[model samples]
Target: MVVRSLAAPPTPWSKNLVEPKIESSAFVHPFSNIIGDVTIGANVMVAPGTSIRADEGAPFYIGEGTNIQDGVVINGLEQGRVIGDDGKQYSVWIGKNTSITHMALIHGPAYVGDNCFIGFRSTVFNARIGHGCIVMMHALIQDVEVPAGKFVPSGAVITNQQQADRLPDVEADDREFARYIVGVNDALRAGYLCASDEACITSIRNELTSTSSSDSSNGSSRNISTSSMMTSPYLSQDTIAQVRNLLQQGYKIGTEHVDERKFRTGSWKSCTPITAKRESEVIAELEACMANHAGEYVRMFGIDPKGKRRVMEKIIQRPDGQQIAQPAATKENSFSGSYRSYQPSVATTSATSGQINQDTVAQVRHLIQQGFKIGTEHVDERRFRTGSWQSCTPISASSESQAISELEACMANHAGEYVRMFGIDPKGKRRVMETIIQRPGGNQIAAPSNSHRSSAFSQPQPAPTYNNKSSASSTRLQPEVVEQIRQLIAQGNRVSAEHVDQRRFRTGSWTSCGPVDSTSASAAIAAIESFLSEYEGEYVRLIGIDSNKRRILETIIQRP
Candidate 1:
């Protein structure tokens, strides 16, 4: 199982070279070593000395019935990533029926939700565990999250967030010994596929004496893709790996379809809008929108175009022996039915201050009416103009309209930078208030005075200079290339900024540091501080582009 296929060479931490989709009832182990941009899903069980690598940090997700047991070691770390329960962004996700047992070390800016159980030599770095967690033997779960159903006991260490909110909950005999190690690795993935096929022992004895078969009788061999079974003939291979993981997670690939009596009486229809953005023209317009609704039910979703919403939906064809239905994926209650879930209503929010600041809406309505809990943190404008922040994910919403609509969807998913609010204390798991709700020009920012708060987190008062009139001294960048140009202009929305120099950064030309026109991450870091104050000292660089103007990042932030 030497999967392989990312001959890396795009640096900004290896940007997509792809090829490792997996699913067709996953089972890897031929002394497993699956490489780069991995995906896996569907009854997964890669055991033998496993090493699911995604080159430097990457796509890596595992999901459906996960069980990666033997010598486990999933890697990661290039500019860290993590937000996935399919709200895209991942350098490791691993949810759905999880159980990474043996020599485990699921690294990366990881996350492990749904039915977790990492036991043997465990070590989940830059963590987040959450859903039905168990953890245990030699555990270490670093840089914490570990919330939902937590347990972690044997040699435990769970670094920070107060040892993952005092972990210790998953009982019921620790979920029946993690369901007996995922039922002995689902019977060692069906006896390693009937010891490499004898027609999978008559398809595992006709799926244990026939219960009227519903797929998974796998007499082995079936890898599906021949251009997704000749242009998606009714998708399914987990909806073509969730439409190539939501078009490599930058979203927008819709399709809908109805008829199973208007999908049980409701009216989905929609299908004519993908307008392709290459994932082979959006799976050839999602196989011509499931071959023009081949007798209805279709489904497919993922449209997040800057949260006008519609994430996680999946049907991908139905009504012919109908029994598809999976769609559970929840990370803070999946965006309430999106596909333009009618988002236009933020006329600068109100009911007396909406996106925070009316003393953070009375400190998030007195911490969810005093049961106290709510967390969040964000920063941009190049990390709050160099103050840094981060954290956002831990607002398990406990009503006050689900914690102010999850704090207005975390200030509309960090709309142009700086969002705060913490409050916590749910039975002393600390942090009792720390406001700064939404800055960078919402109430036009200015709040200073925790000894002059530039949204105080201390020592960030230096770098934001850029005023040069050339006598050569204009050096600023390299606070990690201005945080990789402020997270590539906060992950696209028609970005396009530029700046060159040093013989046009070695003749690739680039120049107009213009077009960010208030897509406001501090007006695109003040257009790279007015292009390093008009190219003060040669060798500059920058350039982000997107909205199909392609070039997504180029670096060289100021050299000379």
Candidate 2:
């Protein structure tokens, strides 16, 4: 029952008596407070203003090679307070090579596993910290159970109990302190403390021993409710199996198995019922077992080993919850094919049927026989069969002779019409006639004659002469000659003639006059001039005709 008062004078001599089992070879600041039942392991360094207190009830234990930076406070409160056993007390357990940074407070009833990092100003309280966890700066932790290897980010506030709906008024410094504590706890649960399994186990065992002592010293009754009791972390394997079997039988895990006498006392409805405590303990034990077999469970269940076990419990609730097996196929052979249905319709008859041309058919047959496929080489076979060879057949030697003769006749008529229309042969008449002959349906013509020799011979005959002056001037030309003149102009040609035969040919309109003369040459010139004056709008300029021939040209250029 050694009790030390907070107000007691500092004793320098006690330092000699309480020599460290493994003292830090490095400098430790004089202002820092290091007190009671603490074991600072070898090669550890303690910075200035760092306070470490392992009190009489709960001692503080640090593993080898750990560093305590400036402004760090490592302490342990009463132990054995959680569990009922009186012999053991709570302890602060830190793993090997862990670093506790500036202004970090590590107070227990809390367990920290190995190789964890407690960042600046982290706070921890009554939490089970896992190995290899990281607690960043300014974090708050309270009454939480953190698993191993998690990273608690900076400024995180983790609280196990639900806070009041309305927050209590608190100073900034107090809030800051609370955050630090939470941060430390978070680091512990996240497994930043210990790097290895051995270190983790050692930290947990030390914490358990220390907590046991605190529980005994306080003389607090172990009043675990049935729910809590069943969930205890120390349940036997046989007990866990029993719970599992009961769960399989549809008995809820947390339900009370109350004796009638106990029920009369209204304990069944109590907030912390005895049945609940037992059930809680059982649950805890089951969880621990599952945690131990977590790797195996994850492999079987396809879940993370360190994940929450509620999901695992649900999965295990049904007996046949394991992966279902697929059935094998029984039939050995199968056949598949595509099928289509069709319907027939009545045909219609043609109104006017024509015979296919034997000549054209023979030509097509020859083409086909010469390795030309019907559908591939030619198009519109039905039309080709009925029409004249000129309509559908390609030009052959036989077709060419007929075509040439037809073309020659067409050219002759065109030439004759053109000369008669313009009163002279037109320029480029031969080319224009050739073009007309070459057009798709324009190839056919009457047989060529000796008159079709050359352009010189194709010129129009001379016009008949007229004598009376006034009568000649008033005479109207034949309409056929006028039409011929129109055709000649349209054929892109020049026309010229000898005499003005008004009785034989007439200038239809006398809108304008030309030079009058009685001689054959003069009358021809006068007639040409008169024609030009009447239809000057037809040819604005004569390209090839000279000024001497202008009078004759003008008459020829007149519009019909």
Candidate 3:
């Protein structure tokens, strides 16, 4: 392991300063960066481009058999100091047998426990991740404690405490769900522990070959558990068919689509008996298969395969779980006549043959009309794929350029009508129309003014004006307006449109206020401290206004 430090000496009085300490058995790739106060335990594999910078606030501690995968960035919390009971600093403390995948960030005060898998591009900031947790791709975990055995889905942002508490219910997978990932890492760690590159490769190859051969030979002789059968992708076609048949009859496929595809079924409680001791045997088999097939999977499915590892980790409920009833169609073709039918492009000429011409604009337009999306680049590559121009003719640069210019011209001529014909929403139509109109020599057609409510893209509304004669010093807020604000604050609500209106005039049941613009409301919220002092008993605190200019106030209730 290559260990270099940036630990500088502190003042004579402050006694706590340490250098980067990595165990002898640990494997730190040459490209990996280790900065101040980072401690790595035995058999830890730090992959290429991984950076562990324990520079600020606290130190970092990576536990044994943990794999810090490629491009992973772990840092000490920049702000808070979370000191332990032992008087030691707490930073990004990752537990044993954890696998932190590529591009994942762990900014500390983060405590990730044992047997956890932090998926690709996932983030952990100022949070506690319990044991056996699986945080999937693109998930942002900030300032929230994730419980043990919970699965965080892709693109899920668990920023609030309440969201964290309800995470387990959202995740279908439990402790055993991704336990295989840690086992795979353990094997990889052992290989990296070898003296040389050749030795490591040989060791891994020998182990996998032996295991695969043994498993294949003893397949019929050994008893397989339900969990193993469910997860194993290499099960016999007959067994797979039988499982699929069973699931089709009366079962809900709650697991990830990929895993479900493998088992032909999903999260079924009745499938496995918890009372039986054989479940452990199944899990053991699963771990073995995972470790053995790790290399093959990395090759077959690159990294972060199409399975719902992050999003669909939680087992889906029963098929009958609160399903909304839809009207059953008597005929197979339930779609309306308005739905456009797809057609293949007619042009069969290849661009390589130099048959490409300026008439390509018409051809391109035809392709688009037939439901093709043409990008400026990769027109040559995406010809055979869905949503691409499926014409027999290859797209040349000149042809593509001309087509793009023509499309732009068409947009410039009548953007609103084009977007309307293309079934774009009101908001999207406005955006497209704005973009077109903003461009030089483009059309400036207004939005459709058919509705009662005028749009920003339609005829613009005249700005509302307050009584200009009323001086700021003499403008006293109405008694009812003060009462409305008080009631809203008491109810833990901001001065929103739901409770109060911005206008001086009353519109039906909405509580009207004296003409108060956003600037005036902001000043009013700030001056609430002085206003509360004038009151006899009620305590008041002015919370800041939100982006929508809704005033937030708080009433401090006195205890009886």
Which structure is stronger by TM-score: 2 or 3? 3
lDDT of 2 by residue, 370-452 (tens): 33322111112222222211221222322212222222233333332211101111342211111011112222111111110
Candidate 2 vs 3: which has more lDDT: 3
Global lDDT of each candidate: 0.60, 0.38, 0.44
RMSD (CA, angstroms), candidate 3: 23.1
Candidate that would win on TM-score: 3
Identify the superior model by lDDT, candidate 1 or candidate 2.
Answer: 1
lDDT of 1 by residue, 1-560 (tens): 44534423445544555778988877787777776678888888888877777878888898888788889989888778989977999988988888888898988989888888887787999888888888766668788787899776555565668657855476454575476567666789778767777786877787767753432354332324244543554445655555556666577777677774444223566878877765556766776866766766565667778746654455555556242533432111121222112211111121112233333443454456568787888887654545468887677756443455566666776787767666667675655434455655553221211110011111112344423211112134433334444445565534444554543232134456666655545455556667766766653445556565655333344444
Candidate with top lDDT is 1
- Per-candidate TM-scores read 0.29, 0.26, 0.37
> lDDT of candidate 3?
0.44
Candidate 2 ranges with C-alpha deviation above 4 Å: 1-20, 24-27, 80-90, 161-560
> Model 1 lDDT vs. the true structure?
0.60
Candidate no. 2 TM-score: 0.26
Instruction: Please count the clashing residue pairs in each candidate, in the order shown.
Output: 2, 96, 5
